[model samples]
Target: MFMLKQQKAKIIDEVTKSLSNAQLILLTDYKGMNVENITKLRDDLRKVDAEYKVMKNTLLKISLTNVGLSIDDLSGSLEGTTAILYTDKDPVMALKVLYNFIEENGNIPVVKSGFFERKFIDQAQAKEFSALPPKEVLLAQLVGQIQAPIYSLHAVLSGMLRKLVYVLDGIKDKKPN
Candidate 1:
């Protein structure tokens, strides 16, 4: 049983370190997925700098309690082949990847709830996360919004310059130059 304890301790340490900088914690049940499918999922999450880890319920509880995180609301879902996804950056991209996986695979394992920024959100809220654009897209949108007024001001000033150009052209024609 010494080996068992050592495994648990390792898991606890891993969970603690992984969640320390994580902004989003997603819990999913990857029950029916085969090795290939799970590997694909892991690869997709890795692209977004997220990790997928399967843990024992007891160890998960111990780790969360140790790390000062509360999963009380999601405790019910910590059952039956649960795999946790921890993301320090771009939670939306990771969520979208899982959402798409579920969609493409006919929703077999099921997405439970998630811990986002210290708040426990239900599946509906998790769906909202999937609807969000990726970090790059959101940033680009914000930049576009911020630059719109400047572009409009430039266009207005250019219209006045065009009017002056027209006036000068008319004067030149009248002077026969």
Candidate 2:
């Protein structure tokens, strides 16, 4: 009995640490998935610096409370074969991996809900979040947007300088030597 209590305590502590460090926490219903599929999913998530953990809903609720998140807000998500996908690194990459895995596996394990950026998101929101492009791609798009106007301005200035130079040469040639 004492050993069981100790194990539960250890699990709660580990889950609490994970919750505290996670930037994105997605709750998935991993029912009807075989061990092979789950292992594959875990491997894919690990590639993107995310972790997939299956935990008891009660322990997860305790962890959420320990992490200062209101359990009421997430009560609905903490039900039925909860598998957590969590990451402190690029969340979009992790999401992409999960969604891709779902697509390939005929969507067996469904995303129930999620907590991102300290906000609770429903299943639809989690799907939308997964559809987002990776961080590097978004960063590149932002950089392109920022540089477009600057490049246009440089081109305009260069054209004006070229015209000025041409006019100056014409005037000098007409004046003599």
Candidate 3:
């Protein structure tokens, strides 16, 4: 009994550490998902530097408390076969993988709720998050936006220079040789 308690405490500590480091935390109902599917999901998450873990609700609650999060905020999310998807890196990538996996697997696991950027998000919000383009794409778009004016300015300056050169050549040609 004492050993069991010690193990549980260790597990709680590990979970607490994970919770603290995670930038995005999603609670999912992974009921009815087979071992193979769960393994595949874990591999997919791993590729994005995220993790998928099936943890006991009690231990999870304890970990949440340790991380200074109120369980009440999560309310009803801890029930059932809860699996946690957490990532310290790009949250949107992780969410995309999970959503894509769900689509391919007949929606075996459903997202119950999520905690991202220090706020709670529902299923619809999670889907919205997944719909966002990847970080690289967003960054590229921003760079293009920032450079658009510069490109336009260059074009205008070059056009004026070309016109001036043409007028100078015309004047030179008209002058008596």
The numbered model that scores best in lDDT is: 3
Clashing pairs in 3: none
lDDT of 2 at 6: 85
Positional deviation of residue 61's Cα in model 3 after best superposition, in angstroms: 2.2
TM-score of every candidate: 0.79, 0.91, 0.87
Query: Against the true structure, candidate 1 has what lDDT?
Result: 0.83
Tell me which of candidates 1 and 2 scores higher on lDDT.
2
The candidate scoring highest on TM-score is: 2
For candidate 3, the clash count comes to: 0
When 1 and 3 are scored with TM-score, the better candidate is 3
RMSD of each: 3.2, 2.0, 2.4
Candidate 2 lDDT tens digits, 59-114: 88888889887777777788879998899898878888998899999996899887
**TM-score of model 1 relative to the true fold?**
0.79
Error of 2 at 170 (Å): 1.3
For candidate 3, lDDT tens digit of each residue in 59-124?
888998898777786888989899999988999999999999999999979999978865788899
